[model samples]
Target: MSDINIELLINTYLVPFGLKILMAIAVWIIGGMLINMIAKLSRKAMSIQKIEPTLAQYGESTVRVALRIALVMVILEVCGIQTTSFAALIAAGGVAIGMAWSGLLSNFAAGIFLVILRPFKVGDAICAAGQTGAVAEIGLFSTTLTTGDNVCVHVGNGKLFSDNIINYTTNPYRRVDLKCQIANGVNPQEAIARLKIHVAKIANLSKAAEPCIEILEFNASGIVIAVRPFCNNNDYWQVFFDTNKAIADTCAEAGWPVPAPHQIEFHKD
Candidate 1:
């Protein structure tokens, strides 16, 4: 190539592209650092306020991601890319993606609603989507729950929003309904009376409401004795497990045996 042509090319294209590339790199580096700082600060602030951890973390991460995307667009413009055309293409892609994944987008929208409405928070035991469990995490698309048996469940936010959500830990107190099956060996009335007394004496039980014991139904096996006890949410699991164990032990030690299965006999002519 000629000397003059080489010089013209460097001035017209090479130098301009190089400068823009350098500028774009600078923006990417600086923008990433700023986004991180903002997220950290927001999280720290929420922590100081004692806000729910799930909400705080989610908010921080979302904001950081949004800012990073904007920064990327700006960097592309600086690199001599046509930002208007790029933006139009992005919009078109987003529309296609949204259409292709409509259900996922619905779940994402429902997740935002869940976070805003604050129906249930993290660590609360809730019944939703035909499953009952303590909420482990609330994500952008699904809510995670840990069941009684330690199973991790991920429920779509769209379903959770549409269905009824029963939050057990919302109030300070929760009612524990325990059923004791009547056996042929044990006296139903006497057993119910004893259970009522035991429930009242148990630790952490709310004294505000008196425990009630009654006969619910009589099945083929035996009668069902219902024991309703109220306790603090913090002590819910403890009270439940302890009461079940205590009642069984008490009945066994006292020789109050459950009856055998009832069977109907038919006579043939």
Candidate 2:
């Protein structure tokens, strides 16, 4: 190439454009490091505030992704690219992504609300999204539950939020309701007194609260006795099982039997 043409090439394209390219590269490298530092500090601050671990992780990831995206735009501008066109392209891409992941976005939003509202937390035994289990992990998209049978269940946050959430651990105390059907001939007063005594013997029952044992409704089969026993939340299931077993044993031992269904048969000619 001629000396004049070589000079023009270096001056017009190589020098200035190359410098901008180098600057953009530098910005990308430095920007990444700064973003990382910011994310680290944000996590530390969240931890100091005792934020939920799942929330903290999601927050850090979201912030980091946003910062990286912003940094890329700045780098593109520095490289003499039209930022307006890039922004338009980003908007289009974002809309497509949003449409594609609408369900995921909804779950993400629901997860954020869950983290903030805290209807239930890790280790809480709850009934949500039509499943009963103890929460193992709360994630951005879904929650993990360890069921009573030790099965791991993944329930979407959107569904969990939309449905009824029965948190067994919300209150310190929970009531154990036991329905006992006794024979018609058994003395109601004696049965109630015996049931109350049996309930009081159950483990983890609150001594402060008196159990309400009474005959609620009677049918042709038997008398329906409502046994309400209050116990700590952690010991709810234990009390429930124990009370049921105690009731059956007590009735059997006292000869106050639960009557068999009286079915009548007619002879046909």
Candidate 3:
């Protein structure tokens, strides 16, 4: 090929193409960094305004996704692609896209409702869709939870919103229910009295509510005494374990016999 023809080819196609590619990469990197900064600033602003953390996080995530989408369109425009035409194409296929992404749309809707309803918030310990944990984040499509075992779980908002939600952290305090089984010979009234004293001494027990100790029922094993203590949600587990220990210690100190099942034998001829 002639040098003139080669120079024309390089200038006309290669140079422009290379420049477009570089521009696209620059836009992508810079756009991403800017989006992150904006999101961070927005979150900080929300914090300053005392906005709810759950809503703040969800807003940040949604804004970031939207900005990223716009950035992609800008990059496409830089690459000699017409974003207007692309948008038009998407609009033309909106029905098909909506049908294909029905579940995602439903999840998004459910997430909005979750935020609006404020059933549970970030850091709340809730059981939803059979998963119990502290809510880490409420996203557009799902909610993140950190379980007692420290497992991170992401549950679909649709499923979580549709199912029963038990928000343990909503109330000021929760009741810790424990059962004590005493041998038939042990006096139920004495056992109940002892339990009340020990359970009252448990650390973090709620001062707002007194411990309730009463005979629950008579079981095959023995007389079942219900030991109920109230404590803040944050101290629930501690109070629970401590209450159990209190019951055991009370039984041992009283020298009560171990509860065992009793059965009557009969012979029919």
Candidate 4:
């Protein structure tokens, strides 16, 4: 090749390629900044509309990802690189990933349903999947709960939705089911009357529903008393513990002893 031809090749080929590279980089940087700004705006808008924090965060992330993907395609086209093959490859990989992690994808989908449906909200006490707790957070894949005992648990949304959910805090009032045992010798009617008096004195107990006290069963141990009352959900534990203590104290004060398991002794001559 002639020296002049060599110089022409460097200017025409190498310089243009370098410029294209620079342009691609500049486009990526500018596009990335704009995408970030849009993501922030999306988050702010969702927040203003009172969307769940986890859902809003997931939305922002999804938007940022889509924007970056489009930016990559634009940059490739600007650099004279064909992206149809790239898009096809990405689609193929996505399908493979989806097939391989179908369970996880289902959980993600269920999480989205949970957010949109609002089956339960943050701070609500719920019983689902055999676990009872207050909802701490709802994530894209899992829902977090803080149990009454203060232990944290992460439950997949798929499992949560698959089972029945009991939202204890959905209503301001909750019906408490309590069972108390008294000495078999005690009169069932008398015991029930004593219980009603004690139940009335408990704080936060609802007066809308009259307390129910019934003699449920007679066992070898003692007569079983079933008590049903209404109270605020927030006062569930308090009312439960207090009512139990009061029943026990009242029985003791009345000279009634709770029955203990017994076995007959026999001797043969």
Q: Residues 93-118, candidate 4: write the lDDT tens digits.
A: 99787788898989888987888888
Looking at model 2, residue 107 earns an lDDT score of 94
- With a 3 Å backbone cut-off (N, CA, C), the pairs that clash in candidate 1 are 183-259, 184-259
Model 2, span 164-236: residue lDDT tens: 9999988878888879888878888988988877878888887768788998998877788998889987788
User: What overall lDDT, based on C-alpha atoms, would model 1 receive against the true structure?
Assistant: 0.85
| Rank list by TM-score | 3, 1, 4, 2
Work out the TM-score per prediction: 0.77, 0.71, 0.92, 0.73
Tens digits of per-residue lDDT for model 3, 112-206: 99999999999999998989999999999999999999999999999999999999998999999989999978989998888888887899988
Count backbone clashes in candidate 4. 0
Q: Which regions in candidate 4 have their CA more than 4 angstroms from the true location? A: 1-40, 50-83, 92-95, 261-269
Q: How accurate is candidate 4 locally (lDDT)?
A: 0.85
Q: Worst ten-residue run, lDDT, model 2?
A: 255-264
Q: Could you say which candidate leads in lDDT?
A: 3
Clash statistics: count for each candidate: 2, 0, 0, 0
lDDT on C-alpha atoms for all candidate structures: 0.85, 0.88, 0.94, 0.85
Candidate 2 deviant stretches above 4 angstroms = 1-44, 52-90, 93-96, 262-269
Error of 3 at 218 (Å): 1.4
lDDT, candidate 3, at 214: 88
